[model samples]
Target: MRASPPPSSSLGSSCQSSQCQTEGNCMTDLGSIRILYMEDDPGLARLVQKRLKRAGYFVDIAEDGEQGVEQYQAGDYGVLIVDQNMPIYSGLQVLEILSQTGELPPTIMLTGTGSEETAVEAMKLGASDYVVKDAAGGFLDLLPPVIERILKQYRIVEERQRAEEALRESEARFRAVAQTAVDAIISMDSRGRMIFWNHGAGDIFGYDETDVLGRPFTMLLDATCHEKNDPPMSFFEVHGEARMDRGIESLGLRRDGTSVPIELSISNWETISGVFYTVIVRDISERKESEAKLARMAHTDALTGTFNRHYLVGLLEREFQRAKRYNHPIGFLMIDVNRFKQINDQYGHTIGDDVLVAISHELVETLRESDIVVRYGGDEFLIILPETNGETEIARDRLVAAMAASGRFVGLVDFPVTLSIGCAHWDPQDPRTIDRILNDADEEMYKAKRANHEQEGSRAQAPPTFA
Candidate 1:
């Protein structure tokens, strides 16, 4: 219930010095700041209410401690004034109840003359100050100043709390953003020790945060990969260096000691502790593999999987130039399968394709890695060998034996197929241009084919054979 209203003793919007009985005791404006007063005595509660209301503060009076606690919780009050003695709950009990909810507002205890000890106990329960009651009402004037001082202190505390809460939210947002990145995000301390590691780091480097944190940042790097180049991590090891950059390719070491190609970026920032670095690493292994595949496709024969004519021209040109400069001999062997058209016509195109694949595989296995086999055209191939001077006859003979040694379906055919090869060997001093030499080899291949056909002699042409 509301406390009794005061008798008709009032002041202006603010208390004048003469009205307060003490010099320079004027009330400042209390804008929208409410007050809660708990005083069981009817006369005193009304007196305090009227005086504060006239001094421009909206005041709500609770006649008992229980009612005071309820009104304190229900209202947005700036200050609480509770008397020590009450009907149900004492001033200390009210303060204790409010403290359980959260930090209480600026509260002052009204104590009787010898109850200074109890006031101190109330302060421990979160009361800001205590006022001693007197028979003459001399303590009434002290209320305004005590309330003002406590509210000032309360404002300062609230601002600091707001700033701290804002900082915590900002950090939470940053951690969220770091965790969502697809690439690995790492944070290092001034000593280059990892302090923060995101989930992406775990996925890429095959390591957990527990396994990574407190480890040196350099542990993830392959030192051997950067020996010829300057190390990127060195700038932060010292106090000052402009080592921050957006990107660079580096080899990242995994937990299994395998190397992974990664595009990495690191930047340094200053904090109170010293310098820190943020490193972002992306695994580019798939991208590198794709680029290599594209390069191969651009220069490879799709059906036979041998080097195409385009690659052959480039290789021939480069090799010819090198042979001229180094004064070495380069050899070209042109080979064709005899009766290939008859095989495709007799055995269908599917078996023809398989035969072509098989032939290319055999040629690849027989040739040295340095020798390139080109699918010059259908049923024909060109072999380019560098620094293999005067080895054309030997190389051709080796190939013929490899093809003829094995038992193959060629024996079942009416006419067995064979490979006819033409060899051209040239020295740097030879007058023939590389193109002319290639043309001569092509001509020689037809001559060799006719010679083989004459030896095989008269029969319906057999199905084509790669033997």
Candidate 2:
């Protein structure tokens, strides 16, 4: 007599050979699904293979667990169906081997009757699903559905893993950019509490992540900042409406309690978690110092350190306007160094420059702080005395007296430095432009020069005194 078929679960009385063939043929029409089958029993293995092939599956049969592992490594099968009781190695061993090779495929295990313990052990070893073999051989009907479900689940797991890996890479790139930026980059929550601070922030603010995290953003700003009236949260709420691409200049407070000028740009974004604010801060101390230096260079005379003509013109025009509006008197003194050309010819240009500088120092010393002194070009100076009504002569006399007291010029020593000064007063009622008034002073200065020459001619026989 023929050997009885191995005990296995039945698909039901209706699922006989004819019905199995129909179901297999119907599944086969869908696609060429590949499966690796491992069973020690040749009869059972052949039966399952024939049924699976009929149901649109390309099935590879392995008579033992070792052959199963070899076939699994050699072929790219979508699913592996292994019988638990096998030669060389058990089905669980085969699953473990496949897992070690790489990510194992969706797997289903076939267990003999009364071998439920072995099926459970196979699952622990990475089997996706398992079915028990019965006398009716019905487990073959359940095979196709279990493989289909496991394959669908496997695709979902793969897609999820890929998505998670991409997210990690994206976050790493963003962190790298933020940490390497030159300007301090900071992020805070809607409550104005610090959440993230990059390396640039630590470098600029002198505060490490530990010192700043969860702290109020106002701690890093001066008390006199524009947001002083609002609390930290309120300030963030107000500024979080839009992006500030252009940035505003303000003072930033350092951890050492000193203040630094900073250019700040802010931007905000929102997510389901909450709103976030980002600030980019740049220290502008060097830039401000450079600008101040440039302004001083523009307004000052290089040689004598007095106001240059360009700056003098602007100051005079402003003073003129103020005098006219207030109906006040403004005095302009045109001063020329007598025999300056003779001094340069006899003593070289360096001595002439020294003489000019010395004279400028004297002028500054004699004048009040309110007076404007200018180096009006080579060998000439201009002094503006605002609100000096009838005191123009008194001011000029005082300057001459100061020069005489210094006792370092022509008559006192050998340097021959004397000033010929002519004064003009602006009367608001006169209604003349500042330029015309200045011209009047210039003419008077020339007249004074000629008068000095005549006096020198008359006094040629005697030693000279102060002009």
- By TM-score, the best candidate is 1
Our tally of clashes for model 2 stands at 11
- Candidate 1 TM-score versus the reference: 0.67
lDDT of candidate model 1 versus the reference: 0.77
Model 1 segments beyond 4 Å from truth? Answer: 1-30, 37-56, 61-74, 81-97, 107-192, 198-200, 222-250, 262-289, 317-328, 408-414, 426-437, 450-467
Candidate 2 lDDT tens digits, 1-467: 11111111110112235654664532122234567899988898899988877666778898999988988778767678888788898888887787776666668888876576776676777777788888898888988777666655654555566678798898689779999998898888888899989998888889999999998888888888746656677755554543576777778899999999988888888879788888888989899999988998999999999999989868887887898899889988899988888888888788788888888999998998999899888999999999898888888888877876775455333744667888898877877787899899898888878777776778663322222
Superposed Cα deviation of residue 439, candidate 1 (Å): 3.3
Candidate 2, run of 10 with poorest lDDT: 3-12
Q: What is the TM-score of each candidate against the true structure?
A: 0.67, 0.66
Model 1, residue 338: displacement in angstroms? 2.4
Q: How far off is residue 182 in model 2, in Å? A: 4.2
Error of 2 at 75 (Å): 7.7
